[model samples]
Target: MRRARVGIDVGGTFTDFVLSNGADGSLTYFKEPSVPSDPSLAVERGMAALLDRARLEPGDVELVVHGTTLGLNAIIQRRGAAMALVVSRGNRDVLEIARCRMPSSYDFSAPKEEPLVPRDLVFEIGARSAFDGTILARPPVEEIAELAETLKSRGVAAVAVMLLNAYVDPTLETEVADALASRLPGVLVSRSSQVWPEIREYERALVAGLNAYIHPLLERYYATLTRRMGELGVAAPLYITASNGGALSVDSARARPIDTVLSGPASGVVAAARIALLTGRQEIITFDMGGTSSDFAVSKGGEPEYTTRTDVGEFPLILPVVNVSSIGAGGGSIVRVDKHGVLKVGPESAGADPGPASYRRGGTEAAITDCYVAAGIIDPDAFLGGRMKLDRAAASGALERVAQRLGMTGEDRAAQAAEAALSVTTAKMATELFKGLAQRGLDPRGFALIPFGGAGPTHANLLAEEARLAAIIVPPGPGTFCALGAIMADVKRDYVRTVRRRLSDDGAPQALAATIAGLEREATDWVGSEGAIVEATQLSAEADMRYAGQAYELHVAIPAALGKTMAAREVGELFHQAHERLYGFRDVDSAIEVVTLRVRVVGRVPPIAIPELDKTATAVEPKGRRRVFHRGQWLDVPVFLRDRLVQGQGFAGPALVEQEDTTTWIIPGWHARVDAVGNLHVSRG
Candidate 1:
């Protein structure tokens, strides 16, 4: 193979790698234990291993794409740079006020989430702009100078500026931020318009704050990763995956880490959508079961749903991100009995350090992986190709504590506990899947489950059965699917601005046209700066509108071809159509208010070719058999090596297809077949 490209995805428990050979479309996968304290170390080690596995020299690599949740982790755990916020005068409490809505209005005891920037750290000035892009007031140079001095004295690492109505025009805020930045020379500075630019002062300010908060941390990680790659003699251009299911230049990512927060999950969903495009499975749900948590995202018509109303932990994220819902349980998720004596699978994980009880680490707590072992779903001896040994007895002993707490006794007590834990985990996943799908007015039965991750395949059939899904599609390299997805990402960014005006007003059309034109220019310039890898760029326009008296807005897509000539009637009709599609009805008589306008910039990257299976091969035979507990009993099941399976190879009922990374379970009454691309297609017989 010549000119190899590599994709690396860092999960909570393991770092996965996928190497693509440009010569023959071959792919090689490998994984290494993730070091939470030093994630880059795992990436470096995995890169070397992947190169060796693929029999390619480091110099042969042309590109490297990476996906990480480090920024998101930092935000959720609130472990980031000490940041200060700059706001418009009289709006010092915007962050605290937060739409005047509590997380739970009825729960009097619920504590408010601490703002990323405390009140003391929030500085306000009279830098303001009007709704029509006019400067209302500018912070005095003397006041700006004083604020910068105070920030420097306080030893703040980064600063975010959000003047009132800055979305109307960023010039005033940008000028003030630039002045402050000059006074405090080294501190990083971000402006709301420069970051997300969306309206809803609180969300826009938080977006800028979040970007500044996580910048230093992600910047350091990227520096380390790039330096290590250089030391390894690899000259490949490095790119980072974005939450919009695309890749961004290292420069873009280093400047804006917030864009990469949900990239890891988004990458997997991107891969699933690509699979759907190739195989004609328009309705599919991607089940990404990683080490810490399992995430599910739905794709229809070969595209994953995107949302701007997402959250990172307790904070709101207004950027466009592929919609993925996380389930609490995963491979490393700790399993225990709650105070009520009911088995609970986790909201906490052992991570990679102690990992699961079966990993033979120092862990004493049972995890989802342990349950896999106790149930015989994962071959203890064959785990990770036996490079690391697992102690089934330890796994059982760990589950024993919970089994005892649940008042169970018997030789198979631990097995029963494991089964119960799996049931609980599966039920929780199914219920969450149902709810998430219901929000879109979709039914789970109409969608096929595409499972990918360390343990997704092993548990997919169980989930499908419980959720009453139509089928399961296990991608060839299920374990490294996210990494695979990373290589296929495009260069993307989203821009938003609030345009609060009634569509019926005569001047509203002109204002809307001007706003969209400005946003398009920003998107175009941003896309142009995203490096040369973006062969072509396209724009998708959208507007969030609501009937005059409606409480919420419905987002409607605008045809990119119309550009600046868009008419008010056209915009209203688009909103009406969107409303009808979402709610089954539209009110044409109701006056509409354009709440926000959005622009999505996509810089298309060249496609990566996937290897086609060697179709001329002979039929394969079972590699072995193992006794697995199923439906409350232990029964012998055929086990086949995944690599041995060829195109069109078929298997049936309660069989295990084992690969180094994961295992796919074909449940009873289900049949499995390998497609041309070697994806395992499983459906009820």
Candidate 2:
């Protein structure tokens, strides 16, 4: 009669589920092949299978936290609802002029990104606001009525309102949006300030526009999912994971779908951080390699790094999100020889439908997964715990084609091609990892790589060796780690306000305190409204500070205790210290300008206790041996069943630890040990 909390993550190829028992804290993991046409179908199918496997009924579930890439895929594929933008007069070119920066500096032929809303679809309004929160202009109701009629005629399913200086005072813009919504019965309406009330008009407008663009698609998906869940007899409250490494109520997510766009990867990073803290690792890099791409996120001191600036497809996103960078190819990334006779891994993926040639779907091209099968790293009959059988001949045939394209004539040409392709992929990932760490002034040698996703553990050792990383921590059930993360996430949200004023100003101290206090009130109110999901609440604050005349500002954290009581001088000192730490110098003599204030609220959830694995005094033996192609030679490698390995067990490479979800490859130069929590700690000799 123990209640279960299910965490689900919908991926490109599979839908992952993690069921945590409320009474004993034991966990169960399951993965189902994704339904590309309707992702909710996979969730429904997976949930039923998982409940049956665990001998639990749907009514026994207490909560369900879910994360999806539906909104993200819609935006990336340009398949979201047809949306129109309503902006202040003379600001019709906001998205068009988008910082006026070209995507590539070296490629002159690079085309600019297509704006979400076309120029023809963008309507102008007289509503405008001044920086001081004063209404400069307001459009007549008749004008708004006419605009709504025009939008309806144009067949836009949704509309976004973003007037000039709407961030300062959202009232006028909200009124305009409300007016439009009243006229347009079925169209969804969104206003800039309600979405993200930052100072930048372009960024604010994009936030609202992006929210509206994906709102209809998500609404339909959520509705279908809710109905399906009910049909399955589950009455638990549903929570959706957010981009900021947190969870939001389904209602909240429906209102602001943009916040959930990056939730998929963010969930993995969140779980990685939790694992880092539990393992006492101070610095770690999370490497998530799924079907479509490989992503890397850095965590320090048990917390994942977060950024206010990131790219969503071709658009710039200013929303604060767990900082995750897409590094290189993944399992289904195509392997090909370019016309110049140079081998390339991918920027194009085969995805789930065709998947890899090994899946025996319709794909005829060689992919990374096919290379694994061709290279003997993956056992064709043992894949997915024998749930699905892979075709080794089809995989080899695909690689053979690529080998022929490379003009290789040996009988082992396919194996050679796979080894070469993996080498290319590893090199690309290592280079990108180094570049990302270098930008943050971090050393690759200082961090342990924690890899998850279906293919992450399978490729971790190769990446670590190429990057010269000291170690890797392969967590238990790596494939379903993101789903586990969804269960561990707390209810969280961020609030921001732009208050551009120099600390030297007479009223700056009171203004800063007042702005922070107001944001805190809003944050607390939001957390309170999240219902029984929150066990306790915490608040943190930060300010965007810069020297007067500086083009950019640095985000400086203000201590929670001093948030309301800190004077202007103390705040300036904190900024100076932060600047010194980051840039190695402080412009102490310069006047400090506070451009924006940010507040983050976190609602704590009861932690799930993962039981430790049983220990054994006897040395573990290999389950079998597999012939693997390594460094141009085929070698017989010992393979261990991951489930049979006991805690405190130690082993050396070259070896393969096979499990239901993934396989861990320990190269010849490394050693591995199992921790109490069943995580494999692999390190160089």
Candidate 3:
């Protein structure tokens, strides 16, 4: 009668599930082909399959933590519900004038992002608030009624209200939103301050708008998901993973869907961070190469880096999220020769339905996965533990077409094309990785690359070689790593308030302390309301500070003791220290302004135990040998079963470690060994 906690991650090509036994901490993984039309269907299927495989009844599940890309897909695909915007009279073009920056500064012809709410659907009201929380004007009841009627007539499913200076005082805007909701029943209304109360009007407006835009779609989807789970008789509290590498109650996610939009990659990063902590690695870069794209995130000192600004499609997201960058193509990225005779690896993906040419699902184009097959790097018969057999001939044919386009005439033309395509893809990823690390003032040589996702380990060695990385850590169950991360997530939430005042100003300390105290109360209350999911609660604080008259602000963590005391001099010193760390020097004489205060509440869940492998001095034997293409030549490589290798066993490349979900390729110049926890550590010779 061992209860289980299930974690799920819905990806573009598959829905991954991990069932953790509550007593023994044993993990069982499953992956089901995704249903893009209805992602929830894939979740249900995967859950049922996982439970059956684990020999557990649905009722034995204690909790379910799930992450999905539904909201993210909707935003990227522009298929969300029609939404309208309600703003103060003078600020109608907030989305249109977003930061007044072009997608490309050097390219004058670069088009601007299409506004989420069209100008015709943007209704302006007389409600306005001064910068200091004073209500300047309030829209009349008649005007509110008229606006509601107009919105209803326009057939918009939701409305986002973003009055000017609403962050200062949300009451006026909330009142208007309430009135509108009352008049227009069934239409979802999201207030700017409620969604995100940051100082930037444009960012705040987009947050509310994005939330409203995806509300109806997610609400319907979740309703179906909840009903399905109940029908299965799980009777577990379902939690949704969030962008900040944490979990939130499903109801909380429903209210603020914006937080969950970037949850997929963040969950994987969280898992990588935890793995780094357990493995005693100080700095690691996570590489998640899935079906559609490859994402990279940096973790240092066992913590994932976070950023306050990231992009969702063409829109800027101001919420705090784990900093993950989409570097290059993934498994299904199409490979083609352009009209100018230049070979390209995708910005376009084959996706799940058609998938790669080797999937035998009607795709005819050469994709990265197809190239793997053509190059003989992936054994077509052994894919997915032989559950899904790939079509090698079709893959070879697809690559042959690309080779013909490139005028390759050798008998090994297809294999050569595949190797070349992989080289191109690896180069692209390495370049982007270097650029991302450079922006953070980091060097690739200082960090180990932790590769996950279905294809991450298969291509990790190539990436590591191209990027000149120090090492690669291939985790167990790499394909379902995101799902593993979801179960390991803690209950967390963030709160923010703007307090624009110089550190030396009169009563600044008292104002900062008051704001922090209020935010802490709110955070604790919210965490408390989340039920008994966590064993303990912790609070952390950060401040957005900068030199007076600076164009930008830097986010600096505030010590817990200093946060509680709110000493102006100490906080100013923290900002100065951060400034000097980022830039070479700090202006000690310059006045520091604390623009925003942020508080995070984390409810710590009981840690999951990672089962260690049995130590053995015996040398591991290769299950078989295969010919793999590398650098324009085919070489015989030893293929080993990943599960059969025990701890304290060492091996050298060229070798392949195959498992049910993925394969790890160790190139000729690298050596690999199994750690105590079953992670394959590969390093340069």
Candidate 4:
């Protein structure tokens, strides 16, 4: 009786589940149509089907790790619980005054993101602390009592307390929060220091408030999932993927749901990294294309970059997370020419229900898929393995409108317009990819692009061409890569403490050392309680620092062995080295200031075995040629069956490799080879 681990991912269009039995190393995948209005319903239904598909009793399953976009949806849709903020008397407008930057500098009509908390819901307390952690002002007891009464009167379900300089010492703010929570039973309360003990007041408060806003919702959701799982007879502790490429127990996730907002993308990055390691690739880039959007990430030395300032919806979060980019225009993106007669792809998606015009679900506009059809790539009847039929005439009819608008005629014009639109979208994606990599001093040419999702393999060549990538690795199961990633993440958490000071023996070394020690102890305690192997605890430490007078800061790694014993100059030199590597210049003469110290605790999950491909399988060519679209002309293209392709076998364009779940196209002049591990390496001639 081998234990089984399940990974569930809830996407915009589909809910996917992957179950891996540790004993036999068997993998099973299942998909269910997603319900946008209520995602948990889809999860429940999908889990039941997945369990049944595996033909295993619920009690045989040992762990079920899951990832969802519920918190992200709440922030994007502004549908979280009605929440209020409590700030220092003079900082009641913190949310509105966020960094004071508009989303778009070119569009004058662009409005600012609606603040999560309205003006009336923002109450203030007369409590303040200086940057040096000295209490400057404290509100009277009666005033706090009245403020609590007022918040309750306003029907606020959650509250965030952010007194000025509370990051320096959260005692006053925590006392105030305790009083409010005591008075208003069942009301969620979040303190800025507890959430993000960094210096930026507004950003910290937003993180805490966002956490509070989604707390109740996640609590209820997790409770329901637990009950449903119990009903199915599984009592194994549930785990949820976090944005940092790790897993959290259901209890930890329910406490800080914001950490999982970008978990879906993180999972894909992790999955790609694992595959890269197994396949002997040291550097890789992952492209994940789903129904609504495409995401990409770069990994070096088998580790994905982590960031603490990722944006959730329009709000910035202060939690550390795996760095991944949303760079792909998904399969559902509507293609059209703007009023200027210039063709554009998306930031807008048609979603699953009304997907592309070819789906025959009443869509009228042309999309990327229509262009693929016009160019003779995707088969009209073989989509989803012919389980779903796409209307080629409808697709061509819609694309003709685009061709006419773009001043073209015949298949040449239609195919050219479609190719050009794809080129434009690919260029946009490549540019974003460049920026994300540039920030880390990474070069695209050094990495292989691993494209997944529905459109990942289909569009990988075009994107790889635009990004100038050296190689592309089409994974064994590219479509469900993220779900696979969720199944692979280890259980982990992060801890932080604020310790602002200049680095010197006389400056705040003792204080900084104490702060770092305290954070490590806290991290150790939390990780210890998770029941992971006690002796195998892995702890990583880092600090946030900036040159004095600079408005921004950079996070630099601090090896855990140093712990509190690290000297002041050693810390300062770490920032200088990191800054020089990133910016190509270091401010050697500038004084350095430490803003925060962070520790990451990771408890390794059980190891996963990589599935070996059957190299003894035979290879075959296409049954026949089809008039497929490419380069503005129809060519008789040879298609190969991916399942039949064997290791060390090679194929060249103009060729189409077909699989049950996806299709890979090798554009003219390019070649593809089946590697030893069964991955398809498509690259330039």
Candidate 5:
């Protein structure tokens, strides 16, 4: 009767589950086709299958960590509940006039980003606050009641109240929001200051609006998920993964669903970061290729980079999140010929409903996965442990349409087209990876590619070669790594406040101390609530600082001891050091200023160590051989079963290693060997 800890990640095409038993340290993986109409249904199904496969009772589950892209999809697809924005009288167009700049300054023809709240739905109240935390005016009780009536008449499902300058002091904003919520009854009302408390009016408003937009949808989802788990005879605590590469309690997530918008991608990056720290591979790139898209995160010195200025679609999100850049297309990305007969892969996906042509689920379009099958990268019959056999003929037929459109005729036309589509996909991925690294001045050759997800390992070698990288690491159970990451994530939350003042200012140090103290106090209480299930906690603090008169600021790590009243001179030095690392040089003589303060608190979760495989006495035998198209010719490549290989067993190039979840291709002129952790490492010959 071993209690199991489970992690489930719901993706566009599949819901993945990873089960870990602490008693024997055994881990099992499972995948189920996703149900787009109800993602939770897929999760429940997958969890049931995983538990049964592991021979564990539902009652034996201790904790369940889950991640999903529902919130992000809602935002991107603009399908969230209708929400109204309540702003100060003069700022009704805050979202419309965002930043006063186009994404492309020179392209006047560029389309403007769609506003989260329609202008007609925006309501302006008489509440007002000065920039210095002084309440200049308050909304009249009669006026508020009228506004509530208007919102009710409009049938807005949620309301976001953002009074001007309320970030400086949330007292009035909280009162107004509370009053409105009471009047609205069932409609959710969120205050900008309560959601983020950041200085920028527009960003803070977006945060509140996003929370309100997703609140009801996430609430219903959690209610169903909870009922399903309860009916399964499991009483385990549930945690939802957050965008900051951590897990928060389900209650916290329901209240702030916006924080979990990037949950699916963040979990995989967190897992890679943990592995990097443990294996001492400090400088590694995590490449996660799932069904809809491929994303990669750079981890250096055992930590993934964090950003506060990332974008979700065209909308800017001013919250700290693990920076993951979308680099490549995914398996279900459609492959087609444009009007000019130019072959193209996708930014659009087939998703789970029809999936790829090979899925035989009413899909008519050929996708990247179909290319993998036509080109011999993935075995059609062996996919998903043979539980769901792929339609190889159907895949070829779909691809043949594209080939005929290209004016080609022959048995090799389909293979040629598939290879060409794959090349286009890989080339695009390589280019994005190079450019993303260029932003940080990182060299691809200096880093190893650690690829996970169903398609990452399958395409890693090609990407590495195209990007001119030296090596690749394919971890075991790559397809389910996101779930593993969800399980590995610690309980966490982030806090930020604006303190726009120069260190050289007469009273800046005391103000800094007060602001830092206030933020730390809030962080302590917040993390405490989120980490109620954990035993210990970890905390880190950073200040966004810049040289006086600089347009942008850099985040500088602050010592915990400096929380009370850090010496202004020492703080300046830390800023200089951070600047030197980021830029090629730092000006020691420049006056420094601190713009914002950020605090991250993590509740430490018990780590699950990777159990080593038994040492092998001889090289593992190949399961069979297959004709794989490579460099314009078909070659018979050795195919090996991944489970047969133990630690220290070595293999050569021109090989295909097949597992239940994914396939790893070892290209010519390279060699691969299994490490102690059962990871397949491929490097140049």
Candidate 6:
């Protein structure tokens, strides 16, 4: 009897599942058209179908890992619970007064994202604390009870508690939360300190409120998922991918669903890192081009970069998550020429139902996928292994319409028009990639591009060329890589605390000791809840510090044991050196202020190594030849079967490497070789 591990990833256009046999290390993938109206239907139906295809009993499954985009979609679409906010008195409009800075300076027509919590639902109580952590005022017991009753009577779905200086001391905050829970048994209650114990009242409040807004929706979905898994008799503990490029237990995930909003794309980045390490590559960029959107992430040394202040839809989250950036360009992204004679690819998508014109499901507009078929890069007869036939004529006709607008003729001009449309989309992605990397001082030439999604490999080479990247690594089963990532994520969580102090021991001894102690206590509690997954936890501590009177702060990593032996003058010298390395200058004569402290609590999951490929004496052969449009001409290209390619097998350019799940095209002057882990490594001569 063999046990199985199941991983499921739900996308806007398709739901994919991967079931790997724990006994044999054998893998199987299944794809089903996603039902966007009710994503869970696709999950349930897809799971059953995948189990049947793998010839495995659902009872034999030992673990089930899932990655979803439901909360993210809900926030983006502005579809979630009606929530109320509870703020310290005199700060009734903290949300409305966010940052007070416009997103765009040039476009006056551009509007700011609407706050998730409206003005009427915002209630204030008399709770106040000074920046120095001194209590200024506190609400009476009767007043808090009345406020709770008022919130319940107003029919608010959830409540958010955000008080000034709550991060310094959460005792009063917890007292209020207890009162709310007792008064309104069903209404969800959250405190900003419990969610993110960091400074900046507006940002911290938003995190808790956003969690409350998406709470019920995610709770229901998780309940259904758990029940469905149980009905199938799989009793193993379930894990869900988090935006931090790690997994969390079901209970923890349910409590902090906001942390999982961006998990899906992050998973692909994680999988890319794993694949890169197997191929002995250190610098890599992951390109995930799905149906409705495409995303990219940069990894160095097999670790994804993390950002603490990334946006979730229109809101900002104060937790650390893998930095995966997305743009509106994918296979299902609609393309049309504007009345101004300019071609536009997407900010709008045909989505799954009316998916590209090539899908032949009532769509009439051109899309990037349609261009792939028109340019002959995708075989019309072998789409999804012939499971679905694309209407090439429809795709060509749609391109012709755009071509006519540009006054062109012949298939050559039509293909050029299609490529032009794709060029615009690709250039948009490249520009975004450049800007993001520039912020971190990273270069594209130092990174290998790994593409995975419906059209990831198809577009990887083009994007890499534009970005001037050195190489490309197309992994096995590219389209289902996100599911593969979910299966690979480890259980983890993040912790932080705000400490305003000078680095000198005499000036900030009490503050430094208290902050470190508080962070350790929080990290210990979180890691303990993770059970055996955290056999030995790793803790990384850093301080957000700046020169006195400086508005912005720079994060500086500090030794975790600094509290015991480090002298005040020694710690001050450390800050000066760290500041010089980051900003090119240090303020030796100026005073330093510690704004905040952060700790990352990581729980290690058992490593899942890439399975070794069988190196038998069999030569991988091309299925056939097809004319592919490239470099202003059509050339007959050899399309080889990916699964048949053995380890150490090398091939040259002008070839299409086809697999059951994806296609990788090796351009002219490029060579590809199969590694022991069965990844296609493409590099220029």
Scored by CA lDDT, what does every candidate get?
0.89, 0.92, 0.92, 0.82, 0.88, 0.83
RMSD of 6: 2.2
After superposing candidate 1, which stretches have Cα over 4 Å from the reference? Answer: 507-511
Candidate 5 lDDT? 0.88
Tens-place lDDT digits, model 3, residues 1-685? 5379999999999889989987776889998999998888898888998999998999899899999999999999999999999999989988888887878989999977789889988888999899998999988888998888888899999999999988878899999999999998899999999999999999899999999999999999889999989888778999999999999999999999998999999999999999998888999999999999999999999889999999999888999999999954999999999999999999899999899999999999999999889877789999988989999999999999999999999889999999999999999999989999999888899899999999999999999999999999999999999999999999988999988988899998888988999999999999998878788999999999999999889999988888887798899888888999999899988999999999999999987778888765466799999998888789999999998998978899999999988889899999999998899999999
Per-residue alpha-carbon lDDT of candidate 4 for residues 371-442, written as tens digits (9 for 90 to 100) = 777777788777766766788888878877888998887557767777777787788888888998887778
Clashes of each: 1, 0, 0, 3, 0, 1
Clashes of 3: 0
TM-score per candidate, chains pooled? 0.97, 0.99, 0.99, 0.93, 0.98, 0.95
- What candidate 2 gets wrong by more than 4 Å, as runs, is 616-619
Indicate the worst ten consecutive residues by lDDT in candidate 5: 611-620
- Whichever of 4 and 6 has more TM-score, that candidate is 6
* Model 3 stretches astray by more than 4 angstroms: 616-619
Kindly report which residue pairs in candidate 5 clash with one another.
none
lDDT of 2 at 581: 91
Q: Against the hidden true structure, what lDDT does model 3 obtain?
A: 0.92
List ranges where model 5 is wrong by over 4 Å.
584-590, 616-618
Candidate 1, 111-195: lDDT as tens digits: 8888889999999898778778799887777888888889988999999998887886788988988898888877999888888
Clashes of 4: 3
Q: After superposition, how far is residue 113 of candidate 4 from its true place, in Å?
A: 3.3
